[model samples]
Target: MPSSWLAALEDEASKVLPAVFFEYFRQGSGDSVASTDAAAAWDRYRLVPRVLNDVRDVDLTGSFLGTPASLPIGVAPTTLQRAADPAGEAAMARACAGSGVPMVLSSNASTPFAEVAATGVRWWLQAYLPEERLLAVPMLEAAVASGAGAIVLTVDTPVVAAKRDGDGPSALTQVPPEWLRVNLGDAADAPKARDLGVRDIAWLRELTGLPVVVKGVLHPEDALRAADAGAAAVWVSNHGGRQLARAASTAGCLPGVVEALGGAVEVYVDGGVRDPMSALSALALGADGIFLGRSPLFALSVGGEDGVRRLFSEYADGLTEALRLAGSADVGDVRGLEVREF
Candidate 1:
């Protein structure tokens, strides 16, 4: 894990990840528009800095759904980390452990659960809705036995949003066979949520003894809906601008969610989170924590473990600077300040 690894990973991503992922991960129309929007919207966002306060110690530690992570920053779980390195999830897990951050382990991950848990990082499991109940149960069991502290039941997809090229028809051929072949018992043809909801997850919460954080929340009504259904946390995200296009910025949607969740649940925000300033703004707006999704992948694709490490390091350092400059000593410190929205 050399200090220079991130630069290398970014270089690699420029060549490989874009072409392959654009086909496999990106959606057409609104989805494709969202990708361009993500780049432009993130570029236009600037942090309003504060000054002249006794800012000696800046603490970024916080907990999401009872798990104590090192900083306010953590990984947001994209797909195909293996495409970047053989170590894949293990490399990312080790980097999180080294940085004292938590990581969301995706159901789409090529690395097995036990291998990820063995890294001693705080493992948070994510499960795509399996079309069949039979396939879903065992993986839920895996999260408990494998030592996952929380289950992030993702709620965004009702169907795989089709790339404009195929229009909801089978585009599986477009996915390289070399990138195929992995599973948690028929994880192939994984179900795209027939009707995702809170009741569907209550049993999972009961089974795991770990908190369940529902991801993909955008509406305040949905936030209320999830808390009522028994989620310990609500993650406001647009699936990294890949799942849906022209979606409201997750940061732009947190306050209404916070108002809806009231005081009973933790609220997290993700999407278009490209830097510490954006993260700081989300936290100040009402998010208890923020999720770092694509940047690390960008980091991983360029350099491997070291690249991910540098990405987290830069984010953590930049966040601490944000806190100090904001006249806030910790994540909680920013809450009392009045935000000036333009």
Candidate 2:
């Protein structure tokens, strides 16, 4: 693996990819403030370490929604991964499976569900609920047929957000034909996109035996409501600031969501998590798991599956050192670390 940082990988990807695909991964919605600030917000909190606490043998092992992972991190779903490399979602699955981590496959993924599932990684299917029940049902059937362990309903994204200049034409021209087909059959049969409500959570839960997770929730009450509505988990996210500009950062919203749920259901968070330190801080603040969106895509662009693996390997190493410094032995010990906000 190359000894390069994520920023360097971003630079490398920029040089190789088309301007459209490059901008798709590089820029967030509306001035990119929410996306940029979400990552920068991690710096606002300082870690105050405890000394001489016998921090030997730090453990990174953890479980999400009853699935064990080598680390407490999971890959957040991103679209058009094939744009980064031909292997696309398939490469991501192999990387996560090799590292014993979980990955959520995006509904908009370039590769079909069965092909990616063939990698044998523990994965969850992320879906956008269409207004038409006919369209939504078939999508769920595809996920079930692929053996997805869970279904994550992205309640955010009622309609596509306004893209920054250059995102549309570039994505349309550069993206592969197969990449646009999300494994669900017949574009003509597709349903209109609509808003998701708490009742939909129950409706989805009744249809499939798999556990249902509500994603894109930022409010504490909404998190609690998801749990009440039969959701197995609540994922706190701001859609990587791709939907709404100037939205609150996921990191900022995490604590309240965690506090509100009070362990009734597992809680996961994503948005601007660039490295291990930020990931560790999220665990300390009560998130059961954290997800990486842009970083993994950037890594994929630089080296395909190998690049993605290297990124996870780097995170594991960084987290081990961070655990020792924070005087924590494992994922469980992370919550006790001293965290202060400026």
Candidate 3:
């Protein structure tokens, strides 16, 4: 079951957004088994709370790639935000800035990097390297010039995955091309590089002079390789189950990736993180931080900037309550809490 607050927000979004647009944001590739199972996977772990420790004060403040964040949560990259609201990525950026959390802008974002950075949110730019790596040079250059804190290279999508039809008309077809990727300009149709390798990690880092975080890693060996390739962090994801139909959920894959890195680099996870328990579950399982994909869009659909702010507030409150109940005063202490897989 999804958290009541999140379910309510989603229900509200369904009423507010066009059926096609809503379906586009909600649907995953192929049979949808991975997308459907992503959230439920986190519920399989049982957290053993410690007692007798004082939890008078709980601090949610943390950092992502060494940049301070008010919370350990971030807004994961999603495409075509204009489909959600007129303010689009700018609205999301403002909310993230107000809440003092980080937001990762998508390569397909409707808003430009400079516009997002102007909001003063600690932001990272996500990219899908094209077949000719130079094709991404302009986008990357713009990101660095706009003061992006890091570069998040999405590794799962060599090519766009096939989505199951009949989820109303595709949002891609419904939204105008101009509203889809304002950042790419004329190169909007650039194809993603299918030959991504470990060397690409160093290439991005050296090129941008920003810490590179490799997203969409599930296998421990792959995570280790990314670390050896000098990734500042490895994000455990399956592209929110939009890439592979039966890929393992990030929740299921996080521990192995964490163990593989052995504190060599930061680890983050996304997909199906609906509530405080799910967020805490990821941390107790060894994730340095957690992110929300659909939930933030749902919030945007309902109340634009304020909706996102409220969503973050709810998570912060819920996390504080959970930490108090578990007798942990801070996020780092939550990592020491025991988690058992059933």
Candidate 4:
């Protein structure tokens, strides 16, 4: 409803990006829920608006594990950014750097981490760990050297999700022949992808000094385990509605993880978040931070860095409105929101 260039980027991306990328965000795991999860999670309450309390300037700046963010939100790890533009991660990094937003770089990305990092990327490396030490070891070390402020270790794919179709062998046939090989070596879960994901994170903590956050946690118990295992933060996510359909909403999962952390570690979330309403709803449900997935990819598909800026600004404005409407003036004030218990 709020007008901004972000809607324009989504419109342009609809025209340029491949059908699959658009479809990826169109459908989500939360659609299966019979009721509006937002209604159950939060009251449709307006922030008893104040007429003139002299609230002129709004600050969108914040930090994610000590890394600066132009806004409280930042880009989540989406597979390949280069699919959208030649600069890809480089453009994203520079743009986020310019905006003071932290850009989390994907290990599966098309652009090398070094290139993005060179542009002063506030990079948070995301990886899937392997059982083998040799493979995981080097990647963790490299992330530190790459100037990543933190490491987000993905643990959900203990094996990849079981999709209804084309997820198996059929997926290979889907790639166009013209698609160039920018992959590190091969597809994920190979000897390399797995190795770097698993134990290397441990080494990264012991060796590189970059704080590691465990991604893909959905249950409170797992969040507890991750914190015990040296995770500075735990992200409750289902892979941007792509990995699994009809899974629990990340918003639903956030409360438990936040409690499990007991304020010892940060609890962040990503999933089924398509707007600022959902954004504020998530924070209301007790998430220390929120991560946006498909939105950024679609933004990249349309206009690269400019598209990202537009989308992010839209989110910031949305949050501002949500805050104002909800009667909260800042991200911190969102804690007292009345949640509808089911």
The number of the candidate with the highest lDDT is: 3
Tell me, by TM-score, which candidate is best.
3
What are the root-mean-square deviations of the candidates from the true structure over C-alphas?
A: 3.9, 2.1, 1.3, 4.2
Summarize candidate 2's per-residue lDDT along 38-155 as a digit string, tens digits.
Answer: 9788777888887778777888998899877999999999988988888899999999999889999988788888998899899998888777756667778888988999999898
> Candidate 1's residue-wise lDDT over 110-157, tens digit each?
787888889988878887766665667777787789888888988887
What lDDT score is found at residue 226 in candidate 2?
91
lDDT of 3 by residue, 1-342 (tens): 335776688789999999888888888899999999998898899989999988888998877887768899999999878889999999999999999999999978988888899999888989888888887888899999999989999999988889865836677888887777678754578887899999999999989999999999999999999999999999999988898999998888998998988999999999989888899999898988888999999999999999999999999988999988878999887888899998
Q: What's model 3's lDDT at 287? A: 89
**How high is the lDDT of residue 166 in model 1?**
44
TM-score of 3: 0.97
lDDT of 4 by residue, 153-238 (tens): 88766545433332333322344432323333333445434333334446658876879888888888878877887888888886
Worst 10 residues of 3 by lDDT: 1-10
List runs of model 3 lying over 4 Å from the truth. 1-3
Candidate 1 vs candidate 4: the TM-score winner is: 1
Higher-lDDT candidate among 2 and 3? 3
Model 2: pairs clashing at backbone N, Cα or C within 3 Å:
none
List where candidate 1 sits over 4 angstroms from the true fold.
Answer: 1-12, 16-18, 21-31, 39-52, 164-183
The pairs that clash in candidate 3 are none
lDDT value for model 3: 0.89
The model with the greater lDDT, 2 or 4, is 2
